[model samples]
Target chain A: MSEFLIASLAICGTFAIYHIALWVHRTWNHSLTAPVLVATTLVIVVLITFRIPYETYMVGGKWINELLGPAVVALAYPLYRYKDTLKKVAAPIVAGTLLGGIIGISTGLLLAQWAGFEATIVYSLTPKSVTTPVAMAVTESIGGVMPLAAIFVMIAGIGGVLMHHYVFRLFQVDHYLGRGVGMGSASHAIGTATSMEVNQLEGAVSTISMVMSALVVSIIAPSLVQLMM
Target chain B: MEKVGKMIMHIGLLYIIFQFGNWIQRTLHLFIPGSVIGMIVLFLLLSTKLVRVSWIEEGANYIVANLAFFFIPVTVGIIEYYDLFLGKGSLLILIVLVSTMLVMGGSGFFSQWLMRRKEWKHE
Candidate 1:
């Protein structure tokens, strides 16, 4: 078998296992995010321990990452369709995103500082709430670790998924717009994805928030890092 | 011929809106993205009855419905970094997990507070 074909099968096999786990858990009224992340990490660990080079994994896995761009462009339709509600809350959406972005970054930096994490790691972390591409760029620009930024993005996603419901209840944030913006600003894409499962309004609002948060972070992270430097 | 023209016009206008949105962000010196600014512009146009919602619904819905599929390529890129993650991955994981929880909690609380303030103003 050709290398590409073998790599493709391995990728498919990984996804198959992920989906099967998802299905089994769903039957019991459970979620797949936590388990899938844990499982993926475990599998990766085993692969690494066995001395499997990451480049070999990329032969097939790169195909999946290429799809993110078009997916973002695809979001335009929902935003257009739901323009009315979005307009009604535009002020709040902008306001909420700004506030959320500042708080998310500042809080992370402060906590990391309090814990005595290295400055470079802290810089890598400041953009954790944004999506991967943007976060990676921010990290690189600020002289931080790109791989660490990617991991931080995933952590933000899973964090949003795990705590969003409880946070909403605790804060009495019942409105779709508020909930969505909060998720997007805090968790980035993963939070935005899970928001879609809740409702279209949440999804749309969260999408806007995610994009806005990334933009906000792109502008501010560099300056903030400069200040720290 | 007219329908095709209108379809072309619609796409053209959307592209313009997207560009204009970016222009506004740059012009205003805001921290937000041009696409988001475009979303806001489109939403404003729709809300004020300048552009009917039906006009862009088809294109907009098409984009939104399949947002998940778009991220597949990026996620696949994770496979490339598997080795780096394999070494000292625990420290990386710990940082991500802890910081994420902090971001979500902080953002959620702040949003809720802003919502309450908005409600108070109405009352």
Candidate 2:
């Protein structure tokens, strides 16, 4: 097979699968139907059943990943838009994110360690709360496997989205502010989307918390990994 | 037509910043990723009025809004680790879920407590 032809086919195939996943998410409105989860599964199934090489798929897939860099830079726009809110309630958001991030990282590291996973897996769990690009990057810097980091991030996102309401109710977190910060700091982009689905103020706060938490994790994960080792 | 052109042009600007961030990281040997450094640079630019939000707003929004689409290719890479996770997958899932529950509960209660305390002081 010609490389160029395979690349085009993979790109088109990815878009088709993603759009179908988006439609299913639109109709189902469930965490399980999230576009990322659905589309990734579809693509994986197609590849495995066909016995296609991952290198072949990545010929075109790398093009999409290239956008991730500029996309990360683009995150600054949302952070900029919410400067006022950041200023007004910066104390609570920062403190809450710090507290939860510490607890989350400690729990993840300790649990993964106790489970008898290797050093790499435990290190990968360190930055699992951040968005994918950042989490994967942090994982690499800390000498962990990127795929495992991505999987851990997926679990954090989908699980948080699914379990947030019950957790919030149990914790008696009635206000949108608290809920938003919790979701964004703990689960990153997916949790922000969940907050958006419920309320605008919640979404905005979630957005800020997501960025703030990413910043916090990026600064700390490497040393934390070093300490663990 | 012009609006779309402007958006694409803004993306070009951001791409330049991303490369610049890569250069900075290589020179400084920083642990943070180039993309994140670029994010911080872009944030500082907007806040300091060195770069106007209008220049990047539409392009950035379009990209971030479709963030889930970008995850497709990378997530598919998980196929590479099939055997590595076969038996241990469920255990990893349990660890992540429990950690997430702890984070949500801890963060939610902490923020609400602080918020209530601030409100009480105001009253």
Candidate 3:
């Protein structure tokens, strides 16, 4: 097959599966039906079953990835909408996120080191808490493997969404802002989407936290790595 | 026709802002991602009334709402590293899950604590 034909099929197949997963999520209201997770699983299954090369599937996948850059840029809309609320609580949000970013990177690095993982694995784990693009960039700057960093980031995002409700209930955290900030700082985009399901306001706050977490981590991660070394 | 026109215009504006951001990042050698700089540019444009929020609100909301869909392809690309993950996948999963919970708990607790303290001071 021509690359054009294969790429088109890959894109169409991904969109079709993703919309189906969205429909399933709406009908069943199940968290596991998160469109990204479902689409990823289905795509992997098809590729493996058909013995298609990952590179072939990526012919179209890269196009979709390109769109992600703009989608992330779109996040500024919510940040703009919620500017008033964010200003009101700006001090606490900044302080909390700064603390969260520091604690997250340190613990991951320390744990990986104590566990005796290789340096590359430890480097990859350093940026696992932020969104994939920023995380991958920070990983590279800090001498980590890019793909491993991406996988670690995806795992963090998915795990944060899955554990958020239980964590909140256990901690008796009833504050919406707190919930949104906590999830966003820890899980990034997926957690923000999950927050949106419960409340628009929570989702808006999450966008801020996610963006702020990325900014802060990118600024400080290199310095922290130097400090560690 | 009007809504469609507005949507196209808004998306075009966003792309321009993103391009500008990329330019800035490259010139300054900033470590931050270009899209994030684009976000700040959009925020500033809207806040300063240089661009009306309503102009882009519909398109931006549509994109943000479907944000996960945009990430699907890049995520599926993870399959390219299937071999690298096989040996250490379980360990990675454990570490990710544990650290995620810790970050969530730490941030949530801190924010909640500060909010309560502020409320107490006011009352």
Candidate 4:
């Protein structure tokens, strides 16, 4: 197939899969239908079945990826809108994310190592709490594989999205800020999306937590890894 | 045409903020990413009444709503590392699942505790 045709197929296919996933999520309120997971799986299946290279798929996907920066920047709106709530809970939010980042990285590193995984995989696992972009950078700087970091980040995200509600309920954590910070600190964008589904204030708080966790993890991860070694 | 123009203007403003963030990073040698810096800048702009929410609200909401689409490519890039994951994928998944749960639990409980403490102090 031609590049034009492939690009069209890639874009159209992703759109279709994401819509279906969104429908499923809305209908059943299941986090398992996260659009990113479903769309990624469908896109990969299509690429493999057709023998299209990943690079080729990205020809169309890159357009969507470019928007990620803006989308992240756009988080400021909700953050701004919810600034009063943020101010009220600022102390706990900061403390929660800071400690959460440390706990997440340390626990992931220890487990990966205890499992006897390679150093590279262990390093990749270190930044699993943050979003992909920051996780990838941390992985590379810490001498891990970047792509593996993305995978770990996704796994962490999906895991958080799928389980956070239950985890919060289990602990009787009904506070919006607590729930938001918990999900965002551990799961990043996916968790933020899940929190958004619950409430707007929760979503905004999650965005703040996600950004703060990214900064904290990136700064502390390298030194923590050195200390562990 | 007008909507397109507005969207462009919104994104352009974001780009300008991003540039300011980049400059700050370069000047101070901060480890923070430009987009994050831009987010903070925009937040301050909104807080101080320098920028109205309506100016970028539509574009921002539209972009944030469809944010998942933007990550599909990066997630699919995981195929490039299939071998690394293939052998230990289960273990990695287990670690991710367990640690994520622990992190969520820890954060939730910690924050809840702090909130309760504040409430008690007030009482």
| Candidate closest to the true structure, highest lDDT | 4
Question: What is the CAPRI rating of model 1's predicted complex?
Answer: acceptable
**Tens-digit per-residue lDDT, A109-203, candidate 2:** 88999999888888888888888878888888878899789888877886787788688888998888799889998888778766655655676
Q: Which residue pairs collide in model 4, if any?
A: none
Question: Would candidate 2 be rated incorrect, acceptable, medium or high by CAPRI criteria?
Answer: medium
**TM-score of each prediction:** 0.70, 0.83, 0.90, 0.88
Query: What ranges in model 4 sit over 4 Å off?
Result: A1-5, A49-51, B1-5, B19-29, B120-123
Which segments of candidate 3 are over 4 A away from where they belong? A222-229, B1-5, B120-123
Q: List the residue pairs that clash in candidate 3.
A: none
- lDDT of residue A203 for candidate 1: 89
Which candidate, 2 or 4, would have the higher lDDT against the true structure? 4
Residue pairs in steric clash, candidate 2? none
- Roughly what TM-score does model 1 have, to 2 decimal places? 0.70
Q: Using DockQ as the measure, which candidate wins?
A: 3
Off by over 4 Å in 2: A116-124, A131-151, A157-176, A189-204, A214-229, B119-123
iRMSD values, candidates in order = 4.6, 2.7, 1.8, 2.0
Interface RMSD measured for model 4: 2.0
